[model samples]
Target chain A: MNRLRFAPIPAGLPATVPFTGPETLERRRGAPFRARLGANENGFGPSPKAVEAMARASADVWKYGDPDSHDLREALAAHHVISPANIMLGEGIDGLLGLLVRLVMAPGETVVTSEGAYPTFNYHVAGFDGRLHKVPYRDDAEDLEALIAAGHETGARLIYFANPDNPMGSWLTGERIEAALSHLPDGALLILDEAYAEFAPEAAIPRIDPEDDRVIRFRTFSKAYGMAGARIGYAIGPAELIAGFDRIRNHFGINRTAQIGALAALQDQEWLERTRLKVGKTRDRIAAIAASNGLRALPSATNFVAVDCGQGGDFARRVLAQLAAQGIFARMPGVPPMDRCIRISCGPDHELDAFAEALPVALAGARED
Target chain B: MNRLRFAPIPAGLPATVPFTGPETLERRRGAPFRARLGANENGFGPSPKAVEAMARASADVWKYGDPDSHDLREALAAHHVISPANIMLGEGIDGLLGLLVRLVMAPGETVVTSEGAYPTFNYHVAGFDGRLHKVPYRDDAEDLEALIAAGHETGARLIYFANPDNPMGSWLTGERIEAALSHLPDGALLILDEAYAEFAPEAAIPRIDPEDDRVIRFRTFSKAYGMAGARIGYAIGPAELIAGFDRIRNHFGINRTAQIGALAALQDQEWLERTRLKVGKTRDRIAAIAASNGLRALPSATNFVAVDCGQGGDFARRVLAQLAAQGIFARMPGVPPMDRCIRISCGPDHELDAFAEALPVALAGARED
Candidate 1:
């Protein structure tokens, strides 16, 4: 009776978050990290025009955002080759994942995902009381065949996959993904999370058939667009399933500045391309640095590179701790095999330089333990 | 199934929203409304300082908000004279309500509220499969005694009452509310949504002991502080219950612009007081306008006034539609007796002047029908 009682799902869950942000580390250490090369965020920042738009909209923040988010959706639709009806924008991909889980997965329903994947999606499934079935990665890539097989076997209402996937920075070609699509079970929605799609090679993004009701694709401004702080991301699917979000989403949850910022960001395709190129350059630099430090960096099509430390999860943890102690913010995958690597995001040159200098010293310090 | 499937909790719920934005109406009508005074937003807008902060942070928009919303929560804690652990911020009260209902209510558990209170909360309860137990309003005011009695009788796990309540704009003294609190079930949590508390008279606010685990208070910057578009609201409660949100909330869901705008908004109490005065003046003008049109305007402690249309829900609906058609947006209650009144928000002189000019013609149009 002393503790406030929670429902069964919440009661069974831990208070731990999926990832610790750099801000949390700063508070704990009482000093800011010299480099923020984790969380796969676009540290190079958003376009100046988008920043100006956000500032202009800031004074008018007292009013509620258009619950419909008409303008941004229209802009996003045009930016991608999709209809606005195919989109359902939310707080972020994290928020959209929560809604998708809620709309499709009833309590005790089954959900399928990789053994070590985006924890937020797993968190959503758990929140909605859906039982999860995880498939292990096949040679560092998400095992699509296993995911489809698991979804069919479990009759999962949801099967989640991140293209140009996080943690391992591995991805499969669009043709392979399209071929794997046939194996998916009917009534089971495939959540193709493409949060890092903009940074991915062209072939990594499939031609999403508008009529495909069984698959929904997600994209975020948080990644290549460099607007994660704006918390805008959207899902693309058939009209009926996409429209289902209207039943439960916080109608006015989209912030006004986010709407304006995202719209402007979408219009600035040049900036997006530049950021993508910069990310590719940074990824190569990170890989080279890892090689010089005797670590193998996994091939990455996204903003972050996963460097294999030739060790286990515990060794990666020690290396991560050592890096944190040296005022560098980095992260590693959770769960086995994948945890043998540390993840570093593409940042501005200075931040990358900081990471370069710290990696060797941190590795030495970690080895001393 | 040809029809799209929904989760059990969301099944059978209407695919309708409580309020439609003017933009949506514009899309339907193919034209925009000229004057906006419907949703009780501050047309006076957010502070210049806030807008500047948001603009400055826009470039950093690619970075995710601190999942913990550490800075804002600490600032809010300082403002409210409580520890950081006592506060939990969400997208808005609307989002928090959804989470709270999910956290506390099991399927079919009873929740008590005024019959025509905020429908968003009701929608959330239904989304979580909670049975909503309603109590009729007493003389346009939330019937607290009945709400408390219903909670005790039905063993309701949660009870909601809004101070300076919405729609009818009626409120009771805080001391009376405090006295009625004893009637609630011992284990039931009382959610006092104080979204309009900033504009309410001093006596309307209860001096609750923050350590009381049984009560949680919801406050928003959306109204008086003019940051509704920012989507920032916080709940104050005992540490145990507040921490429970961490277990399920989209930790980084709050956008960066919102954090910056709200922080600046909080620091400017002077603007808030000015807004209160403006709201008061505008409310009186709305009442005078109602009197000139031969309708009775009810007293209000909130930013909006409910003017009796001398008819039923149908007549008020007609009046509202007529005004909306004429480009003066307004709304009314959805349920009985209270629905006889059309709600008008306080706006700048020009916006209210448009309402003043539009009311009689709209009333006449309603009379003809």
Candidate 2:
């Protein structure tokens, strides 16, 4: 049978996902994992208020969500002390990043990111046929300076920098990020994916003027608010750049329950604080668990910890495979250096206990292999 | 401050939505509407089982939905008698349409659709820089033969045909659509949007093979299943064409609640039959209401009735505006001819009563104007 043809850009593109979901792994393993720590999801879950809001709004699913997401944007505007025009909501930061790339970079234009910063961003860039330039991480954190230099050298249209980076669970200070602004090329836009912002120290999240046209900052209910499955995220940036999103975005793409859930999650600051405390404690516990197995847990400001396997990326792969084999779902980075660590999300005590019990056996298997 | 530049395509693209949502109008009016008969949403509401499923899944929002959407897809596959490989889930038909356009049409490639069939489809085409050829509707129904001719003439890569059409609520028999396939350009792919299929007579739906490479059909929980706010829709076609979706789609875009809700809703086919019967009754009532107002109601298979004001587009706009003034939200088409009618959605008795009460007042106001 003759196959339908793809456009030039997508013609050569592979059908792939950045990370294989634990559900996919569970399907492959023929059993569910004891510890659901692979996808960086908060196992403690969203606030009770959010769950309540979702329940209240569940019946209203017959009605379409407000296409403009007016109320949510207004609320977010008030939260950030910025005009609603500075914000654009999307499926998630991953979704917004795709739109951002589409808005700013034509096919064959350059985009820059750290070697293993966020594979989803790279996926978006590839989707648009943007030439991606990877800059290696500096001491585990996203090497902002090297990224800027690469952007300048390549005449990049956009640069993706995530605060409290994924995979390796490392972060750069807010001051350093602010300081790196001077090194960016004149025309390049900065995509600051602060998906993990709430988990980081306040000092690590710079108070950028929302009016600043050079940068777009993304935040999500998926992370700190523990609503990943809701697929709600927003980007705040210059009014003009933010407006660019409307050119290509699915205006009514966001779901009604998600709008309600995120709003309720945002309103409950007390619950956020409690989740933060819980995450911090769980991170320490995870570190202790790693230490007991002669592994070093890299410091993490986000909801996940990256434990260096004290070997190379290959060894880390074996460790990750062994963990999955033992029904403890964890993910390791794909690239070198960063791949030397296995990433584990902060979950409830029971989930963490499962990881604790499974770690020794996983280590034993890795060693035998 | 300097603004970031948009890519060439988006630079000239307008940020337009298919319709101005009722919320926007309500905001402008400084109050809520008495009845929302616009947007064609199932105001009769989703099944209780679907709501229960959503409520159950509400707390699980902390975990991102299965990127593969394995279970839901498997269920949908079973329901359709197609392999899961023949199905691809997305945020909505709108989102999937965008990805489809991006995948197949390179910049300046030709795409054909009814002039005002679905503005969202045209929006995606424009976003991808596709050259759009629009054929006029013949007697308030999309001119399928004309569309096929235009596709052949222009070497259009895609031809969009929505069964049980929106706006005018007119439809073509499946036999006619099947007969028109022979005239399709060799390489052209047909996009059969079956958004209102359940409301449509089965005879109106073509019996195309699931693996038929010539056409792809879209189905949504948003319409018959009554879960628009959930934003879950799927495309069924040849396995290769369906696989093309993953090349650019937001893999994790579908929300958790939606996946569960749609699955449960699909399982409860009894609610669907009841809703369809309710819609049929409502359509008759709306026709009677239109006749009372000295207007003619177009025969409709979908959840809405198109009431011709026995006037032109200008008169319909006046009627629509007056309806808004009277706190009834009804919509009309934007182009000539079809714009002669105002569309009203099926709703429960109280809402329809509100529309009935407001209709006379709105008509009087329009006549006075």
Candidate 3:
């Protein structure tokens, strides 16, 4: 049979994905993991209010979600002290990243992101045929200055930075992010990913003017609010750029239950704060475990910790594989130096206990290998 | 302040959508409608079992859905008698359509679809910079032969044909679609949208080999399964084409609740059959109401009936507006001849009674104005 052909843009596209979910691993191993800590999901679970709201809205799943997500947008706007028009909700920051890439970068256009930053964003850029210019991270955090320089040097149409960065949870101050924005190329747009913002210190959040068209900040329910599976995230930026999403976005893409659950999650700030405390405690506990194992824990402002394995990326891969083999799911950074550290997500005590129990054995296995 | 620059493709794209959803209409009107028949969403709702599954899964929303969507895919594969490798699920048909257009058609490549069928598909083609060649509908249903001709003439890379099509609710037998496949351009893939397949007669569904690389059939939980708001849909095709989605898709885009709900919905075939019967009854009732109003109801093989207004597009528009004013939401097609009719969705008797009661007055209002 003749094979169906792909367009030139997709013809050379790699089948390689940035990260595979633990569910895939479970399927391959033909067993469920003892604890799910890899994906940085909140095993502490969502607020009771959010769960109830979702249960109530579950039957309404037959009705398409409000295309504008007005109720949720209104709630978010009120939370942010901005107008609803300044915000656009999508299937998650991942989905919004894809749309933002589509909105800002044409085929063959240049985009700049940190070398060790989010691969999903890079995936979107490459998917759109945009040329990526990546600057390596500085001290585990996204190097804003180098990113801006790369953008300027390449005349890049897009630049991205994630605060409290993933894989290695390091963050810079909001003042640093603000100071670096002016260095961006005049025509370039900055995508400030704050997916982990809820767990970050207040000082880490930049108070950018919502009307600032030069930057679009992304936030998600997946991380701090514990609604990753809901696929609800939003972008806050200038009204015009935010509205431009409608031109290409799947208008009814967001589900009704998600809209309701996210709204309830946002409203239950008390639970959010409680989750924050839990995450912080878990972070500290993981750090203590790393110290006991003669490994160093990188400072983190997110829901995960990166433990330096005192080795290289290859060693980290061995440790990760051994951990997975023991049914404890964890991930590590993709690049060198950073890849030397294995990342473990903060979960409930039992999950962390499983990670702690499995780590030493996994480490021994890695050393033996 | 400088405005963020859009990519050349998005820049060239219009800041307009084919259909402004009823939620948007409600927002613009500053009031909610009494009955919603505009979007063709199943008002009868989803299966209780599906809803229960979603509600149960609500607390786990913090964990992102499995990127591979393995379990759901396996279930879908089993149900369809195809390998799990042959299925790919996404946010919805709209999301999948965008990816398909991106995968096959480069800028300026030709694509074919019915002149007035599924505007969202056309929107995607234009958004991706594909040149669309349209063939007019023949007798209210999509003209398969003409679409094939246009596909061959223009060397279109993609051809879209929806069985039990929208706006007009007309259909062609599955055997006819299979016969028409011979006329498709050799390498050009066909997108067989079976969104309303559950309501369609079995004869209208073809027995194409699941492994055939020549075409992809899109199935959605949105219509017959009654889960539009869940935003879950899948495409069935050959392994290679199905695998290609991993190259560019928002891997975690499918919401957790949606995955759970869709799985349960698919499992409960009894509910699906009951809903199909309910839809048939509602369709018949809608047609009867149209006949009583001295309008001609087109032969419908889907969940909605298109009632000819016995006039032109202008009259149909007027009728639609008057219905909106009376808090009854109904829509009409966009193109010329098809726009002469008003499309009403199948709903519970109470909702249909509201539409039925409002139709005559709305028609009178249109005639007067």
What are the lDDT figures for the candidates, one per model? Answer: 0.87, 0.90, 0.90
- iRMS of every model, one decimal? 1.8, 1.7, 1.8
What docking class should model 2 receive?
A: medium
Residue A223 of model 2, lDDT score: 88
Worst 10 residues of 2 chain B by lDDT: B1-10
The interface RMSD value for candidate 1 stands at: 1.8
lDDT of 3 at A193: 92
RMSD of 2: 1.2
Worst lDDT run of 10 residues, candidate 3 chain B, spans: B1-10
lDDT of 3 by residue, A62-102 (tens): 88888889999999999999999999999999999999988
- In candidate 2, what are the lDDT values of residues A1-369, reduced to their tens digit? 142888889988987767777788899999999989988998989999999999989999998999889988998999889999999999999899999988888789889998877888899899888999999988888888889999889998898899988877778888988888877889888989999999999888987898877889999999889999999999999998888888889988999999999998989999999999999999999999999989999999999999998889878889889888888888888888888899999999998988998889888888899
lDDT at A150, model 2: 93
**Docking level of model 1:** medium
Predicted structure with the largest TM-score when compared to the true one = 2
* Model 1 whole-model lDDT (C-alpha atoms): 0.87
Q: Give all candidate RMSDs, comma-separated.
A: 1.6, 1.2, 1.5
lDDT of 3 by residue, B1-369 (tens): 254767777888888877777888998898999888888899889999999999889888888888888889999999998899999999889889989888877789889999889988999999889998989988888998888888889888889999989889999999999898876778688999999888999999998998887789999999888899999999999888888888888998999778988999999999998998899898889889999999988888888899999999999999999999988888889898999999998888989989989999999999999
